[model samples]
Target chain A: MIDLYPTRGGDEPRFIDRQDPVVYGTAEDGPIDAGTLAGFDRDGFLTIERLIEPEEVERYRAEMRRLGRDMRGDERVVTEKGSDEVRSIFEVHRVSEVFAELVRDPRVAGRARQILGSEVYVHQSRVNYKPGFRGRDFYWHSDFETWHAEDGMPRMRAVSISIALTENHATNGGLMIMPGSHRTFVSCPGETPPDHYKHSLKDQEIGVPDEDSLTALAGKHGIELFTGPAGSATMFDCNCMHGSNGNITPFPRSNVFIVFNSVENACAEPFAAPSRRPEFIASRDFTPVL
Target chain B: MIDLYPTRGGDEPRFIDRQDPVVYGTAEDGPIDAGTLAGFDRDGFLTIERLIEPEEVERYRAEMRRLGRDMRGDERVVTEKGSDEVRSIFEVHRVSEVFAELVRDPRVAGRARQILGSEVYVHQSRVNYKPGFRGRDFYWHSDFETWHAEDGMPRMRAVSISIALTENHATNGGLMIMPGSHRTFVSCPGETPPDHYKHSLKDQEIGVPDEDSLTALAGKHGIELFTGPAGSATMFDCNCMHGSNGNITPFPRSNVFIVFNSVENACAEPFAAPSRRPEFIASRDFTPVL
Candidate 1:
């Protein structure tokens, strides 16, 4: 492990890959423009205040609730509290039409292409159900690290879009991401921690940066919380360090995450050990999310 | 359902979407020309005689054989015989990196993009194994028809690359395609029949054209069997009418099939009832494969 916390610090940020076209488009509003693109390049993430409509969000939330009721299999549907409570539904797109449509929505896919300059495929799809009172904490970690070490992915060419299906505010433990941390490539060691696949009740640990190191990194880049009304969507680079706290508020935090990886940099299974997670969770089908 | 068989007997072909840039390149040969592009447009398919070298083909075949040894789950590993023989390994890309690389190869993806004029994602992947003694027949049908009705694929904007791993000739029951049938959009009916998933031992039927319909179609626009040495790769449009015969020869007919769909034309779950097939086999991840 490289202990990637930056020593030198400033509030001001440095941006790279400025020339690539970044789209500032939403589901309600069709086309994207140049200014939105620039902001994304500068921050390594973009926030669409209202990407999905409220009605659609309600419909999907109801669908998620229905799906959570019937979920079977090894470790797909997990929980912080035991006995049928929802935590996350792995690969929700396959089971629900609404989720599938969200993944293929041109509003999201168009921006992904603009940033990547290549065809894109969904690396993973999961619906995080952070129920009030018992919701658990997700320790700080970069997604690319786990993908590279465990799934045999060769590069950090993916982006994850977290769409809020419920109000996600600071009190409810919304996503907290380190600003501009995409520039700091962490050399994380170890395979996917065992608890990552199933429920995180016993252990909420997978490639978590040590506490002191995390404190230092947070001090340097600072942590930015993604809190918004339902339908708000945030697109973050795969390498951006992100985590969420345990939700104790009455408000539930539910979000659908769709991660897009560039086709040109598609991975081979690099790890010597086979993945414990099933195909649906860590997808092998690299078809571009149309 | 509209029975879309042609009316008259002729070898003449019709072309559509004439302006898109189609590639003439292959793995062995790097550059493509206008003449080759025109041929693909006219015939609705292309043939790359040696996409994989001999050594690579042998490695993949050995890997496939190894995979066949211990396949768990349902009809995914279909066979001509009972229990554990090789007929087709659905989603072979998921289990083996060699197969994944083969599907994502620039040699394949480049031509697909050239013809499609957009980003491409996989529709499906399978290793068709026509075993020596008990290989069965594949009835006449177009792939797009099934995809449109059963999988919610919106259009025929997809292509399949079939590469011969074994000697694909007449005796071994090679692929039989109706040239120019890409112009004939068939309205296929019925769900994926039982036994189409796990094995084909019981029923060899699904969306096959009736005898009169097949006779009229074949009579008007003759069927052509693909015959070539190992390593020969053929790319055909999704709507191209095709099927294969049963084999009794000692030499088996095995081929790797990769289907690519354009991202712009991706679809919702269009079918009335959901497909019974597994997600890995049919694929819901529309992420454009780079």
Candidate 2:
């Protein structure tokens, strides 16, 4: 059905029947079985235990290191406590070959197309670098809440594909998601904390969710931690209530993040009061990925 | 100036000023320097020594072997002299992660966008398997002739980026290109040679270039052979007249090929007498690369 209150372009709300087993297993090439699709629809996200091969993992890891350090004037790399270590690298695809390949990968983006059902574009590409002891906790919130309020995203016709560049686990503080919480939007006092790495967060961006609401949601639907082998991938809906804990463990958890938005449902003009976030944080170009 | 007769969409002719040093060095991300752009504009192509990293090369080679052997009824792989060995793999990006990654690699496809002056799409992709002695010579002809006369490409705004999985050399039938031949379109007696593997060559296609014309052109412009180390990449214009000789050396030359066409100047309706080549051969989807 068409979205009556779309904040962005001419895209209507695109929701898959959380009960559809048929959509998950069906792809033009590669093996994404029917059971997988069913699980993804029922939950807010689906995890492919091993989406990347060993060679690719090795290559990606090496490239990520160089991107976080060697790539000069690479403004996207957010640091931890003003130190040299990287917290996250937003839009690494723009600077490196390896991450660029990941964003448009058929195994990753093809599944996105299966769910979104149209040509999809990369609204954002990021690398969450949860280095050992350096990684901090991310506040609980739905991504769409911030995107709609700050970036002018119309609806939730977007999926975030995260591939593990390093082993993601509980100790390392991998992403923790609230299953099936994407059905409704939660309104809260969203603000950009001053501690944010430059242009990383914006005003009206719901970083810290209300404790009462988060507690109620957690009581109803338990959280699921994204923990897996290197190269494992997960596709989550944009509105999925999610966050990650602090990584104090020696094992660093770094993952490549690619946000695929349906071409018809691209972001609109600036809705935030001050100004829109930079193109790197929230892309303006809506060219669809094949 | 606009294309007087655009094929399908309302796309006009888009040209890159060969004299403009600014176009190459100013990508949002990645190193597409002025020297590279100048080379591409001057010689009708540019070859990057090591675009694919060693790990990616290893991964792609491994995947290509399995795909050539195990992937059954997947008809894209072109075979040797009726042997099990794969001569070429077409539309590989649709099937595997490694190849998919290669097709969209920013270092490669990003350069394509630089020349095409718009979002680029894969018009066709194939790996040319020039084995030690089994490989055949691809006769001299321009790709644009086949694409324009047969595939109905509206203009010469496409570039093919070929990455060498194995070291390509003069002895191993490395690509022979006529520099600056892209300036003119030659109408030749193009036919589908029977010796060509199934799904490799098509009817009403230009394969053999006129000898007199070829000799005259070669005499005037001279030829350049693309011989480089493994992981090397070359981006050549569609209208560049190119072909290769049979490999007599022991070193096998197998390279992954990706043809990127500007979305605006994509292929129109097939002009061939028979049925149009399938999507696997000539993809109709014009979704741009991210």
Which candidate's TM-score is highest? 2
Every model's DockQ, to 2 decimals? 0.01, 0.01
**Model 2 stretches astray by more than 4 angstroms:** A1-31, A190-207, B1-290
Position A75, candidate 2: lDDT? 69
**lDDT by residue for model 1 (A1-290), tens:** 22122211222222222222223233333344566656666677889999988898988899888888778543677655554566788888787887888888888877676677678888788888887544656666777666765566666567888999998754456787778777665544344444354533334444445454555566678667677899999998887877765543335789998888888657666342245346676788888777
Query: For candidate 2, what is the TM-score?
Result: 0.45
Put down candidate 1 lDDT per residue, B24-128, tens digits, no spaces: 233334333566667776677778888889998898788777777757544567655553556677878777888888877888877777677678888788888
Backbone clashes in model 2, listed as residue pairs: A24-A37
Error of 2 at B28 (Å): 73
State each candidate's clash count.
Answer: 12, 1
Interface RMSD value for candidate 2, one decimal?
Answer: 27.7
**TM-score of the candidate numbered 1?**
0.44
Interface RMSD of each: 28.5, 27.7
